[model samples]
Target: MGHDQVVTSKGNDHPGNGPAVSREEFDALFEALRTWGRWTPADRGACNRVSPEHVRRAADLVRSGTVVPLARPWDTEPGPDNARPALHYMSELGDAEAPEPSVHKDFLGADYHGKAVSHLDALSHIAYRGRLYDGRTAREAVGSRGARFGAVSALGPLVTRGVLLDLPAVSGEKWLEPGRAVHAPDLVAAEEALGVTFGEGDAVLLRTGRLRRRRERGAWDLDAASAGLHVHAMPLLAERGICVLGGDGDSDVRPSPVDGVRSPVHTLALAAMGVPLLDNLALEALSAACAEAGRYAFLLVVAPLNVPGGTGSPVTPVAVL
Candidate 1:
């Protein structure tokens, strides 16, 4: 496939400036990709998921505020991909008859490791055309021993200025309804309310208020999770040079308003523009912290699992005052 073109619902194009994703940025991005790439079942490539520079930034943010954890503890069973209401997964307990004490438990019997809730979506998490990012293929990356990020880990810790766009508060709604999407105007309203302006290298966090509202319903359907930066917010973010996007809702939107579009933001941001998406974040505490401080922009830090060749991993990103 030729370079895929991504457009938002408002009818705006979001092509990246060029192929150059900057060595500095690549250093931080490649590490996360290897650990989380799906095609790692094919061939492994050497790359750094995070950069030292990013780590320093995160440290700076932590100094300003407390490090609020962002991931929910993983359970025995994983949930479906759609924005479902409740997550269901299996779990294994240490039964005396189950296995010998000598056997080490490996990520709930899967070869993968790390806390389920903490992770990063390496660029390898999504791909365009027949190749992974930079034209690497799964068949070439996967091997008998399993996938690898080709280094100590696939991604490194990320640090940057973070902003929160609280949709529920701005919309004057108790909460964002399940399946409802927060648009660009909603974002602007939140920014104005908070008196914050977006800037380059900013890691943005949006609250659709969907998860808190829907998870209680017991079962989530197509409308369970809230929609994100679709046609509504992508252009505004890209033009402002946002490096990462975070949300309490799923990063991709389903049943798009556009007939043929399937979560265009996923393609437009990660593949076309090299912008990373952080999802299912536990932001209520952090949001409260920001409200108390009367500030939104701060240092943010995120670290992903080092699982080579994985899809999206759980993530924990917190904003420091």
Candidate 2:
């Protein structure tokens, strides 16, 4: 089917056996990767990404409600390290003397006139050069008419391996200190200690375990948000061929382990490289699940809004055994 075709029902590709991707589909993906000119060096790095068939299978399970999706709670006053928009909704609208329609609204509603936070970043969210992964420019992707890819809506559906790194557990500390950069060594050590190696297409989740403390202290300052990947760490992850990098911290990169730089991770990973980074994820549940399973690897699924050319969206991601 063409990209424009809406996959109305779940499991449309593999009707019976859930969405387990077939080897044939994997081969097709390889073919596309080899032939597609828009594919970047970073995209080439992601060529080993978990097969689409894998994603389909996970989505099938998610649709069945067999996989419990942990809802991401909005952190109204997330500390300095982590800060983003909080979704809200309103059930009632106009005043007693006002017009008939009562305003029932979501903080960012999903109606024609309203806006809702999207869950995924479309390929257009960050382009390598002047164009997107599919060779389309940001200007071509956006317009007064409506939003498209590169917007929150273009990323069709994201699915792959999701891995979590509990930094505090690895460091034997209560929390990774704010402005303290997380290095590649820390990640490697954590992986060794946890006995998990992030695969090429894995969606890596980093848990600083600081956000919980921040919430407990009721301080939403930017400085309190810990758990960020340092600038040097970006290349490490890129070399590993990781598709997505997420954390409970403010950004994926800090200036250095000692220097305090903000949003460096966004610039290096999202801007410099084409790797999409997920921020402010509620990874407590995910961490628990991985620990319970005694395994850090699992099927991950995330579907971005198909808004033609949007930026980022709130992703509804899930982990399955």
Candidate 3:
């Protein structure tokens, strides 16, 4: 169905099956993964892990020259999760009385910091305990003008090896049900099953088959419940030295396993590890492409808009196999 045509119902909360994490436990994990002051003063955050050598190596993975675009369509209708659907309307239409030449124009806008749009979250996007990555106070770094420290402009263009951890494919399931928590063990199992391993400078994308589930079962409140990584999985990702983390959902399993926190993974990845996140990606086509090619790793490139002082940018990342 067209994006605007999908009807949605109140989303059920997916209180994942993982053990509850106390505020203290969550704080400990945050401290353990924190990369504050690790790199030079910069807005790229963990993206600095990707170097020229990494990009060269990633380019070597493109053997079949297959390209997959990992962006959901610009949703123009609101749903339980998409409170602000993208706007698409004609701005100008050709008028016979105007002149001999005719042209058509349209406009587009979105409050993309939601579940419907595919977007990248800059380090400035998340703040924990009143501070951002690199120990910048949120109030001091971000203001009405935008972010001064972690703007998307500092993260120029991202080029690295992309790893697709297809959980459903590994488990012989079509999709992991909402409220399902993917822990460290799941990552290890998926790596073994897919014959792929995580490494530094890699963009790890976890596909829980969210879109497929919605297509088959109809729309529900995604904010209330979604299949994603638990806070327990952050250590593995940090150990692997990933620069980018993305998924069909926002990368956090909900209702958050961490007590008193809404998006623990977001906090861990962005505020603690300084890793940027690609949220709300449409990874179904990438999964099919990987399966057809018999490989899960690819050369991934993402170029966010150079919006100075902006928190993040809407992006259409591309993966080549």
Model 2 misplacement above 4 A: 1-48, 53-71, 75-87, 91-119, 126-149, 223-225, 253-262
Residue 19 lDDT in model 2? Answer: 24
Model 2: which ten-residue window has the lowest total lDDT? 1-10
Evaluation by TM-score, superior candidate among 1 and 3? 3
lDDT of each: 0.53, 0.53, 0.89
- Evaluated with lDDT, which candidate comes out highest? 3
lDDT of each residue in 1-321, candidate 1, tens digit only: 121122222222222111223334433433433323433322222112224674466456554446667665454444332322224434444554754663333333321222123345555555544345544564564356443422113545566678888767666775655445455666777899988877666778887664555444432443223355544456677667676776776565543433344455565565545566776677777767777777777777676656555554555676667
Off-target runs (Cα >4 Å) in candidate 3 are 1-16
Worst 10 residues of 3 by lDDT: 4-13
Those runs of model 1 whose alpha carbons end farther than 4 Å from true positions after fitting are 1-64, 77-119, 135-152, 222-225
Candidate 2 per-residue lDDT, tens place, 142-224, comes to: 56764454444433566776777888877777666544567778889999998888856677888886556555553333332
Ranked candidates, highest TM-score first:
3, 1, 2
